[model samples]
Target: MTTIDKAPTVQSQRAGTGTRGTRILGTLTIVSMVWLIAFGLGFSPADRDQQEAVRIMYVHVPTIWIAYLAFVVTAVASGFYLFKKSLGWDRLAGASAEVGTVFVALTLIVGALWGRLTWGVFWQWDARLTTTALLFVTYVGYLAVRRLGGTHEQRARRSAVIGLLAVLLIPLVHWSVRLWRSLHQEATVLDPDGDIDMDGLMLFSLFVGVIAFTLFYVWLMLHRTRVMAMEDMMEDRGLDEALASRRREAAMPDSEEN
Candidate 1:
């Protein structure tokens, strides 16, 4: 297989740079998260029933939002790869898939913690739990396929196709509780009968947490892409392979020299 001799320049608008705007956005994210985490920990009161256990929301809700955002990234990257076939898109897709897995795992952990506190059980295999678990497993498979399957482009193309199809789970998760009544609650954002009833500071903190976690997600994806690119560079340039080939050639006496 022919490897690309040079590293591809990764450029995506979602990727932040050293520009002042990016710096300011990053700084704002840090400030917001610091305040949100602090406020959620200290200022926010425990739920009337669940008490301190409800406090887990500070960590849980933000992580779930990040997971959703990650799926969005995966969908976009897969679509881009299908249309443009940019190696960058494939790299981003693969990176996002890994990150998404982390967040999905977090979601499961936090959800179980909350379930234990409120329902007095560690887990219940409810509709929400089962569907979300299925979603996580599906993407984990997506990542494994790329790692264990064919060469770079081939694996990427295959993963992209799988990713696009796997994304159907997102909508299913959103509707699972509606389709089947369960212990897990429906989304607070769009309840049909009433508006979201979050307390003032709590709501503000939650929104800020979303922003903070999304920024964190972007930071992770960029770092992941950079690592993948460096690996690609080493494989493509074949510096060691070329050296080994040269050594092999040297071991044989040249007929002309003789």
Candidate 2:
């Protein structure tokens, strides 16, 4: 028998292949994250001076890096969407921005915790922190803008512009410590002399954190993009049904009432 509930079932099946890939990647991400945390906590060497407090860098630095990476993907996707007027590009930008916002919040929270342990405060108006905060707020606003009601093209065009413009803060956040004297320390991994000023274990653990978080972000973006596509598909189905109903009504002859 025919069923009224078949449309979404078909949509879900269409997404099955990609979802399976995401599931496999998500499993690998979980395993890598566990290894990263274990190595950071137990194997990584403590700093010469910071002692136990240094471990936070494994999470703090990597999360902030991923946040930057996410937004950069969003900006590039936005640019491509603008150039091509493609829905695929718009979906990619939206997915990246959503994941980026979560990572930015994590960066702030972890940074605050690390600061309390090392800098003797949970919050500060340091240049890097302030700029990072601004970046977070900007992307949050970008996500909110996406939720505003509009036609697909209208929403995509507006969000693509926002995605491009919001990422301008990334460089400012990255170089804020260098640009202005602040309590935040300068870049460690990107030293001017190309010398990494850290123990081998610490560096290795940092690398692991970066890889793990980046994989997690990719898994998240895949899932988010799929969900967004499904939403759009459902909306399209609803519009199609509404238009077909209107057409049927228009085609009906007026009742033979004098």
Candidate 3:
């Protein structure tokens, strides 16, 4: 196609394809989540030690991973928005941060539930738990900064700074088991050479859980970005209408003078 002919047509075609692709991915995500829950219920081997309680790890771990993914998106997108002044990047950063906070909350809840079973306590002041709690608080602070900022530029800069700083604490949380030798057990699957030590089916189900949760995150981010865009468009339309009304009012007096 000639360049002039391709412009609008190609753009619309790409938009249509992209929309379809997103819808398919979202459907797949829901299916995967359902499949994971079914597989975990039917196939995951009972933990010899913790018995059924260990099953929650599949949900808890994947949720925390989603939180990590969200923050990474937020930091990178915020940087791009600041440098390029792209609303696309800004909306991405905002969407990711909002979803990330929700995942963080879920992680804490599932973790506490898991702890109640395995640790014999609902919560603890130990190094690992404390550090994770601090990590949550830091993200909350980041969200607060974003909400309180005076302008888009101010929010983007402040949120990006906080996100970059908060990531330093994630490793601290992960390593707290070794750094302080607290009651928290060393990570079983993620530790170097630790081997999953889980049954093959259980591992498979958890893998599915991870995929499901990641897709869920993507879905939430997409929805959030679209909502933000609609809000922005509405605000712009409102402003334009107000300006047009003012101009009409101003012109009417001038017409009378003429």
User: How much is 163 displaced in model 1, in angstroms?
Assistant: 0.7
Identify the runs in model 3 with alpha carbons over 4 angstroms from their true place: 1-18, 168-195, 242-258
In model 2, which range of ten residues has the least summed lDDT? Answer: 1-10
Estimate every model's Cα lDDT from 0 to 1.
0.72, 0.78, 0.71
Index of the highest-TM-score prediction: 2
Q: Where is model 1 more than 4 Å wrong at Cα? A: 1-30, 169-195, 239-258
Model 2, position 99, has a per-residue lDDT of 87
**Comparison by TM-score, 2 against 3, better one:** 2
| TM-score, structure 3 vs. true | 0.75
Model 3 worst lDDT run, 10 consecutive residues: 1-10
**CA lDDT of 67 in candidate 1?**
82
Q: What's the ranking of the predictions by lDDT, best on top?
A: 2, 1, 3
Candidate 1 residues 148-242, lDDT tens each?
75567897799899889887766777586546654455443222112257677767666767778888887667667766765665566668768
Instruction: Tell me the tens digit of each residue's lDDT in model 2 across 1-258.
Output: 011011235434464425456778989999999999899999987776667988988998888889888888889989998999977778888888888888889989988887787677787766667787888889989999989978788889999998877766567666864466444554432211122577888889989999999999888877677677768776878788789878887787684342
Quote the lDDT for 49 in model 3.
Answer: 73
